[model samples]
Target: MLQVISLVLENKPGALMRVTGVLSQRGYNIESLTVARTLDPEVSRMTIVVDVDATLRQQVVKQMNKLINVLQASDLTESPAVVRELVLVRVRTAQESRTAVLKEAEIFGGRVVDSSTEGFAIEVTGAPEKLNEFIDVMGSYGEIDVTRSGALAIALDARKLKLQPPVPTKAGVKMEETAI
Candidate 1:
């Protein structure tokens, strides 16, 4: 089964490498991975998609939490979340196919970001399946180049994964454990 795992990590060099290395060492395949800085510049969020069994998914989450740079990790497979991927496609356009291609692109909520006598560059953002369908339709028109941003997702409502700092005890010492 495919699972979406989200992680919040400290924004620092080699943080991504550590996370990916752990997964690679365990022989897990990453279907998609997207990372971007969060509103807080000190932190970054990563959304990773991997195909694995439920037990293995839990193991991956646990391993992620063991990393010092990883502040929070959560499996969003069954959670209420919003996910999307962006795709930019430049398609060859002939006088006979230009109108048809534009109409089809409009049906998928794609915009003509650029156009020339040779082709039109269409930008589309939506669920992965929608983008795949659009690509199939545009294939007949000829694709010159294509670039895609892997899936990015965030949980809905108050149900989200977050990092909390350890509380101080009566002894005046802060705990080292990370709060999920």
Candidate 2:
């Protein structure tokens, strides 16, 4: 099973290494990891995806939480959350296929970040599966180079379930937020 684990850690040297060390020491292979500073400069958030059985999932979370700089650790695989990834692709295409390449990128909602006589550099962001499809389409164009940002995810707000003042909607119809 693939488990998504989110962690909040103090922004200190080696904090990330320590957290990854715990997992590596246990022989867990991380599928993807994305880490960045949060609003507060002193803290950083990390989203890690790993393949592990149910028992191993529990052990990974427990070990992560025990780390000194780790403020929190939660397994988000079982929670309602939104997850996304970003990819950049540079494709070298023949003049005859340039138009088709750009058209395909537009259809995929990709932005042409850079362009030259040699090729086009496109940026796309969405669910990992969507990016995979986009990459496959881009590959058909010609020789290409690709780079990806690992998955980033956040759990939905549980407080949204509580009774509260009605949220205003643009067209007077209530809008519901659903996790992706």
Candidate 3:
């Protein structure tokens, strides 16, 4: 299953490397990660989306908690979280497709942040699928170039949701390890 992990760590060089190294060593695929300085200069916050098994994820969380620089580690997957990914897409445009392009952006709640006859850049913030759907439609109008921020989530501590089921397997199968 995929997990959204938030880590508060001491701000310092190579700190990101260490955290990512742990995931890599365990053969976990990091879907995306974003690191930025927190309100305090001495600390940084990292949000990472990783594809990992439930039991392994627990161990990873425990290990992160034990790290000297890591102050807090939380799995927000089952929480009532607000998650969003920002995407900037550069689309080639021409007179024939300009109208089509703008209309599509409008449908996706995106703005044409930049534009020229040759091409246009649109910015959209929403769930990953929403951004992807916008991009998919762009192909008919023109070629597309996309860049997106890693997923950001705000956990709903008091409004947590029921945990999700494990990643589905083929032939109507199920996983032995349940996501905590």
> Which numbered prediction scores highest in TM-score against the true structure?
1
Q: Compared with the true structure, what per-residue lDDT tens digits does model 3 show for residues 60-171?
A: 9888877766777788877778778899999997888888888888989999899987889999999877877877888778788989898887676763223335676654
Which is superior by lDDT, 1 or 3? 1
Tens-digit lDDT string for candidate 2 (29-65): 9889999999999989999988877887888899898
TM-score of each: 0.87, 0.84, 0.83
Model 3, which residues run further than 4 Å from truth? 158-180
- lDDT digits (tens) for residues 1-180 of candidate 1: 688988899999999999888789888898899999999999999999888777788888999989999998888888899989999999987888999999999999999999999989999999988999999899988756888899999888564556677876854433344421
User: Which 10 consecutive positions of candidate 3 have the poorest summed lDDT?
Assistant: 171-180
- What is the lDDT of every predicted structure here? 0.88, 0.88, 0.83
Worst 10 residues of 1 by lDDT: 171-180
Candidate 1 has an lDDT of 0.88
Q: Model 2 reaches what TM-score against the true structure? A: 0.84
Model 2: CA > 4 A from native: 158-180
